[model samples]
Target: MKSSDISVEAKGVSKNYSSVKALDDLSLSVQKGEMFGLIGPDGAGKSTLFRILTTLILPDSGVATIEGFDIKRDYKSIRRIIGYMPGRFSLYGDLTVDENLSFFASVFNVKVADNYPLIENIFKDIAPFGSRRASRLSGGMKQKLALSCALIHKPSVLFLDEPTTGVDPVSRREFWQMLERLKTYGITIVVSTSYMDEALLCDRVALIKEGRVLSSDSPRGVIDSYQNTLLAIWGDDMHSLLKELRSYNEVKSVYSFGQEHHIAIDKKLYNHNYIDSLTQKLEERGERNFHIKVIAPTIEDCYMEFSANKEGYE
Candidate 1:
């Protein structure tokens, strides 16, 4: 990609909070109008990176740029060009929905009427409760209102930190739909989430853990990196199945995955007859009503693989 097409850039950015390092030489780029996701568990430096890029906090080392402007010297200009919605609801609880929107617009030196078109699709659902105080709104409604206020200024890039963390399932789905709509307006979006499944929704995602990036690629790309033979096994008694699978000397790892357990075996021990041999062994042990089948790897599976690899290296 050309330099002109980049909306956000970070080069070896790092942050230290006293004895703890929040970010460790992190570097990445977001192209114009792209929906980039930062995926990781809590305390994985997602929030720290977001805070740094949004100019709410400064990094301890390295450098970053927003719209090609230096983060330190050009922060004033960067602030005007980006919209930020923190993980928590930071709006005025005492103020009504209408008041919050109007206040943010005024702060940006713009009128709500001027940017109504940009936010109408998201704000319309909560418009009927315009008189309601922000504190009284539901989790989903508050999210929409916050998003509306963020867009009121017509920012070129938006930063959202765990926007769907506490929302309901339906609301989470709806929130992503709203993001999809926003992408069509030529706005670059950078969002962070702990939900591994949400990674599939982004154009690209960077898996982070303990202040380091484990991997960065499209969802499919990450899964494809799992160059291992995996199988899903389940039985009438999941506990027994898990225990029996773990006893196998060839099994590398076994973890519960919804209705079944995803079992990874050392590639050297795997063969076309491996499944048959496992079934026969289970049958010999009087394990009835069990099934084993090869399966595709998921984002969570890939994450676990990376985590395990890191641990082994250490």
Candidate 2:
């Protein structure tokens, strides 16, 4: 798609829920046919942003436009042009797979036969089990059915809010594959997810936290902005060692990364004093056999740094 063809645009959007600020002057633009991702952890205002963009809720100030239509003023047009799959499984549990799809299609005033070509590849997988109730479907199957229903109306833009959560890794991978294929149909996709790994799958991503946008760019662009050298350290008594490690003057930051701890130090300004001090400190505490070394930063690392930098503003 051309860069000028913006499918989603928001300008200085802000929202509040009584005493809590859900979004703060957040602005973003996404081009048509591009797979854009909104990444953040829980309670980071991701859901609020999705709600506003999908026209489920309105912002307190500023404006959001989808396909050149204002979310509040042109909500009916936007709703007709966009397909939304919510964060939770919202299909009627009492209805069968076919019934659920038929219902959603009817709500959108579209016939399943009209969009069969658009969803056949995915719907075929669930066709044999069409009679089964939605409540009895597995996570992967439920996800596929929901996706099919979302596309039944042939929406120009699709909004998926954490659609892969709770599904197994294999199912998550499959879900992403489906997204890639959708791009070929010229549909813009804006997906909000807490999964760091999923962030890399998008052509471009916006990292959001506490209702504010921290960074926006391609996955590689965001990762490239990470300025710190990260290192993973592991040893026994790690639980107790964490406190002593933080007490070091040379350590800039510390975060848990999978099985090990990602330790940050000012290699430019600080000497091995940080490492030596940590080793010595651990030894004094009877903690032994420690291993520490630098490792390449991941998308998750960039997100941590991005969110940490935002904390200063709060």
Candidate 3:
């Protein structure tokens, strides 16, 4: 992509905390007006990378830019053009909803009234509780309030680190809906999430693990890259079935996915005879009421596959 089309860019970025390498030669870019996701679990260096991009901390090596401004040399300018909502609730607990909003607005040398339209949809939900202290607001309400504060300055880029984490299922759904609406305003949203399912909501996602990127592609692209034949198998005794599947020489990998175990096998080895052989083995092991069927891979399945072969990506 053209440099002008890029909103955020990182090249060989690395960070270390004494002996711990938080980020190891990481590199990725975010396009302007695109909602990009960093999909990884905790300790995967998501927060570390956010801190570096937002100017909260510096990286040990490599270079990065925000809207063409070098993060190291143009931190002040970068700060003026971006909004960051950290994973934790950092607003003042003693302040009321309206008070918190006004405080953040004033910090950016702008009035809440001036940008009221930008945050109206989110603020409207918490308006009735304007008098309530931030600490007293429910999890979902607090999330909305934080998002409103972040957008008060009309930032061109917004960095949300695990915004839906710890919130209810319904609230998570609502938060994603709000993000969808924000894209129309032409804001580049860089969000990090551990939820594999949430990766589908982004324009593209980078699957990270142990301070390395395993894959970076559109959600469908990542799933389509999976090479092994996948199968969803379950039986009356899930624990025993899992063991039996793992013991099979032809099984490449097996992991418990919700109520069933998802198994991957070599494409050449996956056939009708293989399925029949599996059935006979399970039946001989006293397993009854068992079922096996071919299944499409999900984002989580792709993640597991990449993680298993992370050395290739790193």
RMSD of each: 1.7, 2.3, 1.9
lDDT by candidate, in order shown:
0.91, 0.87, 0.92
Per lDDT, the best of the predicted structures is: 3
**Ranking of models by lDDT:** 3, 1, 2
User: What residue pairs are clashing in model 2?
Assistant: none
Clashing pairs in 3: none
lDDT per residue, candidate 2, 40-113, as tens digits?
87787888888999899989999889988999999999889999999999899999999999999999998999
Can you give the lDDT of residue 18 in candidate 3? Answer: 97
Top TM-score prediction, candidate number: 3
User: Which residue pairs in candidate 1 collide?
Assistant: none
Candidate 3 C-alpha lDDT tens digits along 1-314: 99999999999999999999999999999999999999876799999999999999999999999999999999999999999999999899999999999999999999999989989999999999999999999999999999999999999999999998899888898889889999999999999988887889999999888887778899999999999999999878999898888888888789999999999998988877877888898899888998999899998888888777764631
Number of clashing pairs per prediction, in order: 0, 0, 0
Per-residue error at 244 for model 2, in Å? 2.8
The parts of candidate 2 lying over 4 Å away from their true place are 1-3, 270-285, 312-314
